[model samples]
Target: MTGTDGLVVGEEVPEFSAPLVAPDADREERSLSELLSDGPVLFCFYTADFSPDCIEEWCSFRDFDWFASTSDVQVVGISKSRSWIHQQFIDYLDLQFPLFSDRDLTIAEAFDVRYRVFGLFERSKRSCFLIDEDRTVRYKWVGQHWLDPTRDVPPVTEIFEGVRNELGAPETETFGFDAAMTD
Candidate 1:
């Protein structure tokens, strides 16, 4: 399917590589297979690095308590921003995940989430994909419209719950604070 239609659940995501800025500020090319090698992955696609919505979405992922508690899943971000911009953004937010630089929107196009904003500038629609070890998409979420004032990031808690139900809980919950403490 074309990028406008976006990928669907059960579709196998093709392996691709892109330049990325790691949390430690290293810039290098990384492939999807390398990421999947660790386990399942949650790919968060956004319009730009410093946009308000992008910041909010990434901060949520950075502070996601479930992420700290789970070693079975890795979360990374993709955007059209350059590697240096991604480094600054990651440092500004203290993000725990790497950010891929899809400056030409090639990766977003492959995922079918690339769109032209105001019918001019190319950008990635806010989207998320839960891809398993087999490279098959298990879950997908895309924002209704980039210009929609109400559009926001997908709910991390709900995604975490779905992952738990599908993959079962990790054997040990060594990270994150006690859930009871939040109550």
Candidate 2:
């Protein structure tokens, strides 16, 4: 099968590089392998940059504090949108994470999240993958349309909890105030 078919858990992220728009709007090239050099990565592939659902999803990631709670997990957004569009999204949202331009769809295809409808509309599916420092897939989720028959992507807190648990770390209620009960 071609890369379009996607990869499964335990698979190594493909050796691929692409242009990314940093939070500062600086353009740079990054390889999946190179990112692994730092630590585990959360590769979040979404349909379109400015789409409402995508905005909501990513903004949640932006507001979530779990990434800071973990020492080495890097989050990256991927889409077929151009670098300028990615830059615009970052600026508009004041996002803290970097977004990469999957212009060729190579990264999406390798992750098996590329979706094309009737040879017309082509984009990456709303998917998330947690790849460890060794480049092995740790967790993954592919989303369906949020309207009907929703695929129900896991909440940020759940993703954080899972990742933290796997890393052998203590868990905290991400958004809940356990302290309120003690008051």
Candidate 3:
């Protein structure tokens, strides 16, 4: 049930709920249905927080103008990390999107993105799904391996293109991190 070949476009994603921690530290439980209540979702599942790749990936989304301005698309990040870890990452990156704690891997199992790295370390593989309001996955990207930088990475431009193709929005450009602001 866990691999890149599992889920596919046009499939209705299974439902799941997990604990979510907002940037301000507000904690609550959220479900996929509740998330779609607002609009379509660009759901991303990462391996963990505080990792270099994850830091760049999440920050790219935060810095992307389209991500911030696209009101019709709800952005939610999920990982196996705990709420405290999520809080630290959010604060450190100044992320505007809320992240969910999938500590139990329920959602990852449902999406079939759960996998083990090097055949030992269990974690959520980096994946993304563009789900419509009807719960059908319109687009998806699943990595082939754990920490495979070439495939497991989220290229900002490609992600934005997918977002535009799925949701039809303002154009996007590669979001570069401002080093001065990070300091």
lDDT tens digits, residues 1-183, model 1? 254656988899988999978998889999999889999988888878888878888778778767755778888899899999999998998888889999988899889888776677777888888899999988877778547412567787777766666667656663354655333
Residue lDDT tens for model 3, 1-183: 456454788999988888988888898998889989898998888978988889888877887766766576778899999999899999999998899999888888888777666667777778888898888998887766545522367766787668777776434432243334223
Query: How much is 146 displaced in model 1, in angstroms?
Result: 7.6
Off by over 4 Å in 1: 1-5, 146-150, 174-183
User: What C-alpha lDDT values do all the predictions have?
Assistant: 0.80, 0.74, 0.78
Q: Where does candidate 2 have its weakest 10-residue lDDT segment?
A: 145-154
In candidate 1 the C-alpha lDDT for residue 22 amounts to 91
Which candidate number maximizes lDDT?
A: 1
Candidate 1 clash pair list? 3-112
On a 0 to 100 scale, what is the lDDT of residue 26 in model 2?
86
Residues 75-100 of candidate 2 have per-residue lDDT tens digits of 88898889999999999988878888
The superposed Cα distance between candidate 1 and the true structure at residue 103, in angstroms, equals: 0.5
